[model samples]
Target: MSLLLAAPILIPLTAAVLCVLAWRHRTLQRGISIAGAAGLLASAVALFQQVSASGPVASQMGNWPAPFGITLVADTLACIMLLINGFLAVCIVLFSLGGIGQRREAGGYHALVHGMLAAVSGAFVTGDIFNLYVWFEVMLMASFVLMTLGGQRGQLEGATKYVTLSLISSMLFLSGVGVLYAVTGTLNMADLAVKFAAVENSALAVSLGLLFFVSFGIKAAVFPMFFWLPASYQTPPPVIAALFAGLLSKVGIYAIIRTFTLIFSHEPQMVYTIMLAVSGLTMVIGVFGAAVQTEIRRILAFHSVSQIGYMLMGLAVTGAAVADGLPGGSVAAGASASASTSAVNAAIPEFAVMALAGTVLFLVHHAIVKTNLFLVGGIVLKLRGTTVLARLGDLYLTRPWLAVLFMVTAMSLAGVPVATGFWAKLVLVRAGLAGGEWIIVAAALGTGVLTLYSMTKIWSEAFWKVTPDAADLAAAGQHPTDEAIDAADIGPRGVPIMMTVVAVMAVATVALGVLAGPCYRVAERAARELLEPQAYIRAVLGPTAGRPASASEPAPAAASAGGVPSQR
Candidate 1:
């Protein structure tokens, strides 16, 4: 399990090095990169097996114990995320094979993709807060490179804005870490959990929490912080944009969940109310933006922001429930109410557990389907040489498989029944209802319908419409698109073999639909582990029973007395 945990980080790093060193040989670099992706997939499988049999796995790097040195902890949550990351990496590599040709800087592309993989996988597994910041920087750097790979005027403009905003976020994240270390005196997440157990209600805690929230919320593209995403994402190629759409923002959501559950669980009222308000607005505004966009990619990007709102809705509702249960809260509002009783204790964790689990599942499902859709868009571009809905039409006549792929993805995104998306929406909405948040439930369901509307609009314009005007093609300085009269070669027939394999893996979309029950089980277990992080704390702080002294203090005399002892 430990070896498998290391592989997600190491395989990418190793492959990146090989790609850079063998830059002159594009084929060799590509081969190494593909093998690394396969290794990551195999490693994820191995890690999942160990987790299923033996529960969570923990590894301390370089013989240094937790707190003092880096620790990689692979609970069900981390492992599940690793699996998604691995799967997406492999699929994206396959998509890029033909899309980014030998003439391009294949090595640079491979290096950046692998580097981003390593960063995301590391962030999922890291036990230390500072380590998380490091991973964030690494991920941002790689993404910046990939964004600018084509070096077109639009890409350069987009990359500049993207990199600038990301750098500001990173600096804010660092500042938050600085404050956290000063207050709690530990960077190890588990160690800090113990160290700050008593301070979660303090003014400093809320202030620091907001700093961290802003940093991650910006990355997650939640509400007001999301302008950068739509602006920059539309500039990248569909393949890269698809990966970003599916994976990047999810990282921010993950961080928000992690911090709130593990570190700020103490002050539910103040922290939670704000979260709920923001989440509601995020969904409302994001979907409306999608409604207005005519461009295919812009609508998808806006939708990304909106779906993030759903995840936060679950979290906010759960937080509110938990808040009501906190000591000296509104539970005593009525004379008949018992002061000792908490409405939150009765239902909060269950709602939170279910909501978070659903969110993660949704993320995994979205990544694959979204990537397939983007790549399919690329295929459409290649065949018809245009993405604008106004210009492109009659795809169903020529590229039926691409049309089929689009329907599957669009239906999945639309939350149709018997699909993985339905399951995700079911979990999220049920969670909202369980928490008594009817407004959120209505919004979520309404968003699902709106999503369908937007998707169907594209379907009508792009595939169902009459054949495109060859005149538009001539206006755009391109050859008139032939009606894909041939069936076999209709959808990218002459494209590289690897692209075909990638398109085939879109079958996972339907497979996940079929396996929703078991996957939900995984998500539930992962969420349970995340909410009750005693195991993580124990791994970091030597099985201590109570919170540790401040970070500046020497190790507790008896390691077990505190939550976990730093082995380092």
Candidate 2:
């Protein structure tokens, strides 16, 4: 079980080392990357099955006990994330074979890609908060190298901004961890949850929570903190951009969900209210930014920010459900009682589980669809030799089949019916309405309209419009076509690997919508585990770990706010 739990991280790290060793042999490197990605996907599936059958699983490194050793955990949430990461890594690596170009591969491209995958898997499973920091640093280092692999002017410029801001966020995260540790004296997340609740200084706890919020909010690309994303994401290769879009920000979202629900559940009202406001603003800003972008990748980058808002909306609504005493409220209130001496535990309303489930569903749907869109953008770049919208046209005329695939992903992203995104959005909207979060509800609906408009704009300019001839373009006084316009560009031999990968993702996007019920059930189960983490705590700590304190119970004397007692 421990080996299975560690497989996702170990496989990628091992693959990266092998790829680095075979740096002089491009074919060998590619084979190693592909095999490693396949292994990761298999491991993730097995881990998912194990978690489903055995409940939350945890492993302490070097046979050490909890709170004293490095711990890896595989709860439903982590398992779901790992599964998505595995799937994306496989598709993206395959696409890279045809799309990343030979020049880039010679510079250790496969190694960096696998390194990023390892860091991502490590982040998903690590149970210790400090170890999460280490994983984030690994991710930043690998991603920085990937972003600048080609050493192009634009790539260097983008890497500079990405790494600069990411480093700052990392410092903030580390500082927050230090403060949290100073207050609670434990780096283990499960232990922190138990220890933090016993601290007397509620103000200090909330302050530390805000620190984490800002650090992760920047990483998640929410609102004002998202400026760095659009600036840098469009500069990298399409596959790298796709990976960033699909997985990077989602990791931040995952962290937010985990930290808030498990460790910071003590102050639901304040934290969630802030999240609700930020979510609405993030949706508006992201769509508006996308509407103004002329480059294909830049537009997609902005849309990534917009979709994050929907995920945050679900998160805020879940928090609201806890505050309002909705379906899952008992779980939150119970978790809080176990951690602290708070008096606001009186039943106010029933917490709706749908809100949390909607967030998870949205995350899954967005990752697949977003990555497909970027891969499609890569195909466009291959066909037209440019990503500028004005320089591109007539894709639907020259390659109708490719147009079909683009429409599938675009419509899914725009939340069109019978696409996975539509169901994902529907659930969030329903949850918000149920929770009476009218502002966020309006924001979500409005964002969807803007999203559709942006998609249609791409369709019209890039596909519906004809590729104007040199004379027509000259007559219009526009800059001459950067690359000669040719129908041959869309021929089968252009990039079969990229096309195959996009097609697979497109089918998955549609299938997710068609099979929404089962997928949603899985998300619901994951959300339940988040709201009530007693099972998670016990799994990591031990069966002897008692049930979390009930909301109605008086605070235990040993748990007074002065400080955590010395009992281990």
Candidate 3:
């Protein structure tokens, strides 16, 4: 069980190590990268299966019990995320083989990618908030390097913005952890939940919650904090941009979802109100930003920000079920009433589950679809030598398969009927409406309309538009686009390696749409676990996990003598 739990992290870490050792041999590094990603996907699937068969699972280090040792856990949510993270790593690795170029490859590109993967896996599985922060740092460092791999002027400019914002977020997160640990004296999330809830300092609790919210909000790139994403994501290599598109902000969203659901859930109304507002603005602003962009990758980069808004809406559009109490074991533990506000927070949100399911499904859909878009953009860049829309046209007539692949993901991104995007939007809209969140529903519907516009912009500029010939370029006073890059092959195996990736992902996007039922069900089940986290708590901290320690019980010296201590 422990091996299974560690496999996802270990495989990627080992791959990174081997990549470093074989840095001189790009072939060996590439081989190891592919193998590691495959192993990660395998471990993720096995973990998901084990969790399906036997509920949430936890593994402690050094044979130590919960609340003491470093712990790795896999609830349904974590399993699903693990699977997505691993799946994308494979796709990105394969795609990078062609596009990442020899300069970056020899500059530790494969090793850094694997390092980022390992950190992401760590973040998903770690049961400790402090460890979550640690993993975030690892992810940040690896991404910072990946962002600036080639030392291009554009890469450096983007890396500056990315690292600057990222460091601020990390600082805030570490501060939140410091405050949380100072107050509760435990960094274990499960134990921190119970202990933090038992604290009587309302000011401290609410303030800390908001502090953490701001920290994660910045990372998640909500509304006002989203400017850095478009600036940075579009600057990297297409494959790297696609990887960032697919996974980076979603990890931030993952952190937000996990923290809000399990730890600071007592006062959800504050988060609810704030998230709805942020989500709406994020959606509109991001789409508007994308609408005005002519660069294919820049437009997709802006769409990534918009998509983050959609994911955050899941948590925003919870329920009138808040009136009934029972949000996160808060009310039952007599901590249900809002400590910050007088609004009743007895939450048993029916729509919350559905909304969250929409989030998970969309996360998967957007990761595949959005990344596929960037990958396709890379195809254009390689074929035409530029991603600027005005220079290129008539891909549909020339590269029909590429056209089809673009449409596959583009339609999905637009939320067209029968695509995964449609169902994801439908579920979220329904959930918001059911919860009486008219603003969220409107933002969702309105955003979809604008999302369609963005996709159409890309379709027209990048594909359907007729080719601008050399004569046309000179007539229009433009540079040569297809001069040296006319249908040119990419990668060691040429176009096949790159095409295979887009083809595979396009198929997966359709499969997820056509078979959205099981995926949604699993996501919904995970939502239930998140809303009612006792099973998760118990799985990590034994049977007594969610239960608050009584003053009558004997105190433990470690974890501030107020934690749910080791029983054996």
Candidate 4:
């Protein structure tokens, strides 16, 4: 348990600190980074073991009890998230060996990566709401530096938009936190869970919840707030882009789920309805955006937003189902008074379970698969020395393995069967039908098909077509600017073998589909834990942890799913 808590946060922080202390020694910095990443992986595995045995572990910082001080909690979900993130860090570190080494100031890049890892891990483990905010800032700061690491014109331009939007989002989030603290007078999550119950249906609480929703929505790239992502994410180096794709947006989703289930569960109808509406629009807009993009990374970036919509759909239905009532029990007892009992009986229609499972499974699978795609793209650009669809050509003959890998990744993105993507969409669609939400079900299916279309467009343009064979391209009459052709020479080409190895490992990510059943069962248990939260509360506040520090009664579990009707 100690290793689980310490390794993810400390291993990375220690490495970053060491690198800073030995900034002049590039070799030493590399050694520290690799060792730290390796230790982080070991710690993740160890944490998984502890979670498997103990259910969940909570460590109060400095040995103070949960509500009074800070605590780091690791549940099955947290452990699994850590494992995926650790694996990504390891692969990206390996990928960075040659690329980051070429840069003049490697120390800062390496240090920032480590710091970013620590921040991400901290966000996952921390039990205090304010702590989550701290970690968000840390991670964003690292991302800004990494995005601009190349010091190129495009990167600087993109980073400017990225930082501006991210800063604004952070300010919004901080302001939300201030309002929440002002209302509840507690920042610790479990402690607030208790306090929030007392104020469940209050206008103040609902308003605060919306503030967080907007703030996290921006970070998560959900719908209206997603404009900044496609513009900035495409400009970073492959390793950094892959890291951002795999982990950064997830933190936003995690925050939403955590707050919805624990704090805002009081208002299921309003929250879930809004989520459903936004999700539908997000899917439509994101895929439509992808349809128009010719750039490889930009298309993938749009798909990220689309996929987030799918993940949220399940939760919206889950909230609706839970609101409809638990299977046969005293409504009052089942309310806030017996949260654990109600949670167990919630019976999230098999489809909902399947959908939620797929969502989590997809999150893990997408992280690996997406990273692999970016790395493979990097390799293609390396050999051809160009990423532009109009200028680049003939990678199929030059790098067969890379071409094949790209095909598999693109197909998986298209949600073809036997791939992890198939199962994700399948479950999501099934859940919508089970909830009698036929329109949502149809929307999800349409998104999958559109996803396929977008993917195939990229495949045909970048891989299948013969480039430089175009009459217009070679014609002297065309007199196309020489600068367009010279832009291809801006970077190195020739896919390195190490990168190819990194890309190939995505096959394992696909294999998770074969093992989906057990994973789903595990996800169910985790979901149950999330919904009940008694164990979490006990872990944080202790059996005798008593009431919230504030003077409000536990919000009554309203008979309806809109979390206990707003306490008047």
Candidate 5:
């Protein structure tokens, strides 16, 4: 079972190698990509089941002991993430069949997509902080290339902004890692959790933790740090935009959740307060940003920032719950207060688990629904030649099914009933109320209303009232300027493969909404593992890894399917 931990990363990586080898043969590369995606999905299913049955598991490379070697660990959290990642891989690969043009395919786009997946999976499973950093670099390298592919003016501009922000994030992350190693002499997360309990320099330790928060904040595109996202994400083709929207920011968010719950709770009152402020502002600013955008992808880009704020809200609530419920409120305290502080370390507060579980659900729902929206946007671009709302008018008449699909995902995004987003928000809101976070809860509700308005903007302007074909675009648009929009330069093109892939994803969103119980259970279980890290520690280190940090020391505290881009 420990071997299955590596499958997610290895499968896509092998496929990427094969794709590069067959670069001269597009058909072979295509078949190889599809097969690889399918295989990853299969592996994810098996791994998820195994984790569910046996609890968390870890494997050390070269059979080295804990804190001494490379480690791959999979708890419920890792497996659930892998499951979603594999599912999105399959969807994005299939969509690329008709959505991407031959020129891009010949440019090793399949290879690049697989490479990106490999990096993402590596990030999900790695047991060391430094290993996580390496995966981030791998992801940056692949995504930067993907963004700049073909070197179009917009693509180059967007890639530049993307790389600029990403490099800064990398520097901050590396600097934090240096501080951590200098202080703790270890980089393994489980080991760090143990040692962090014993560190006496609360100020320096928290400063190190804050450093990571800022780094991940920048990466996650939280408010103030998020300006680059709409500017760049909108520049990619809708397919590429969808992939980034679904996965990249979520990884940043994932990092934030991981570090805060596991290694940064010593000063929770201060940390979570600052975080709550950031989350509230992120939601407000992101929704307003989307409201000002007329392009489909740009609007979605801004909303991505808004949705991320909600994830942080859940994190804040979870942090508060964990800190308050654990007697003495810090790992240092837990270490000194008990004879068997390991039991205290292993315990998870009920409230913290519920809140984080809600966060996990939101993360899953957001990835799928957001990716589905981007694919719908791509279909509109393929058929209409542009995403400008004023230039589009009659898609509802021309493609009723496309309109329905858009409504399905858009409704889900706005948290309408019978959609996964609705349930996710409900859980978060409930958790927030339980934790007495009334202000942030109010902010979240207001953001949902604004989110609906933004989605409505897209529906009314681009989808509800426009011609979907080249022949009628000139006569049907919102302005005489629409005549100058050049129908022939774009659409009325067929997107059967694209539509088919989208329909399947659409069904998935609805199914997730209707059958949300099993998912909720899985999410709650994952949250438990995160808050109670003893299982993870034991898995990576050994059966006795959960022993107290030292004879005199305190106890320790406990702890995306986004797609590839398409070219048209």
Candidate 6:
């Protein structure tokens, strides 16, 4: 069981080391990268199956007990995330083989890719807050290197902004950890949860919670904090951008969900209200931003922010249910009641479950679809030689299959019927209406309309319009770079490697949409575990994990306490 839990992190780290060692041999490095990705995928699948059959799984390093040693855990949510990461790693590695230019490959690109994968896997599985912080740093370091690999002017500029913002987020996270430790004196998340519940200082706890909220909000690319994403994501290679779009921000969302649900399950009213307001603003701003962008990758980057709003909506609903004393648990003590609270409380559990399940469903569906869309953009760049909409056209005539693939993924993104995104949106909208969250429902619907509009703009400019000649491009003050010209001259033989990887993802997107039932069942189970985290708590800290300290009782000393020590 421990091996299964460790496999996802270990495989990637080992592969990264091997890739670095074989850096002088590009062929060996490439082979190692492929093998590592495949190994990760296999390990993730096994872990998911084991967790499914036998509740949540946990392992303490060096045979040490919980709260005293490093711990790795795999609840349903973590397993689902690991599975997605594994799949993306494979597709992105293959895509990079064909899409990343030779200059970047020679600069330890494969090694960096594996390192990032290791960090992502570690983040998903670790049970300690400080361990999560370490993994975030690892991910940030690898991504910074990858972003600046080619040293192009645009790449360097983007990396500077990315690194600057990311470092700030890391510092805030560490500071939050410090403050939280002062209040609770534990770095283990399960242990912290018990201690936080017993703390007497409401103001201090709330302040620390907000600190985490701000730190993760920046990483999740929530509205008002998402400007850095659009400015920088478009500048990286499309494969890197796709991976970032699909996985990076989602990790932040994962952290938000985990902390809110498992650790800060108390004080639902404040948490839910904040999440709801931020989600609405995020959706509105992201779609509006996408509407105005002409570059393909930039538009997609903005859409990533919008999609995050939907996931956050699910989380907000979950918080509301808890506040209303729904099926998952009770409202926090001293929570003030309002006149309409009774009415809202009447329909809590059903809608809350729907919202959470919808979020999981949407998360998986969007990751596959969004990643495919970016890969398609890379294909466009490969054939048309640039991503500027006005400078390129007529892809439908030249490559109808690519156009069809784009239409499928784009429509799926827009939540068109029979597409996976449509069902995801439907569930959330229904949940919102059921809970009387009219503003959220309206924001969701409005965002979908604008998303379709943006997709149509891309379709019209890049596929329907005639391809601009060199003279026309020069007239418009748009000169294709020498690399772009060379890319355009390449024929069908140049596309097969990239095309195969994209086709697989496209098929998976359709499969998820067409076969939503089975996937929703899995998501439903994951949501159940999230909403009621006893299984997760026990897995990390043993059966006695939930025992809280009495108000008059002092906490156990840190060195002697078993699992989570109670608050003093």
Q: State which candidate has the highest lDDT.
A: 2
| Segments of candidate 5 deviating more than 4 angstroms | 326-349, 466-494, 549-568
Q: Candidate 5: worst 10 consecutive residues by lDDT?
A: 559-568
Q: lDDT tens digits, residues 1-568, model 1?
A: 4577788899989999988889888878879989999988888888888877766667677756556777787778778778988888888887777555343454388888888999998988888889999999999989998887767677788788888888889999999999889877778777666566555346677777778888999999887888898888877667778778767888898888888777765554777778877787787788889888866777788878888887888777766766665565423222112221243235346777888788778777777766676776667655655566777777888667677878988898788987788898899899888888887788888888888888888788889888656686567665323211122233454455534744565678778888988989988887777666666665555654323232335553245234322322
- State candidate 3's TM-score: 0.92
Distance from true position, residue 312, model 3, in Å?
0.2
* Tens-digit lDDT string for candidate 3 (256-289): 8888777876653555677788888999899889
lDDT of each: 0.74, 0.83, 0.80, 0.72, 0.80, 0.82
Model 3 bad stretches (over 4 Å) = 319-333, 337-347, 471-493, 548-568
lDDT for each residue of candidate 5 in 387-453, tens digit (9 for 90 to 100): 7886777888888999999999999999998889999999999889888899999999999999999
Please say which candidate is ahead in lDDT: 1 or 4.
1
Model 3 poorest 10 in a row by lDDT: 550-559
lDDT computed for candidate 1: 0.74
lDDT by residue (133-188, candidate 6, tens digit) is: 99999999999888777777777888888888889999999999998888776788
- The TM-scores of all predictions, comma-separated, are 0.89, 0.91, 0.92, 0.89, 0.92, 0.92
Quote model 5's TM-score. 0.92
Error of 5 at 156 (Å): 1.0
Clashes of each: 6, 11, 3, 11, 13, 0
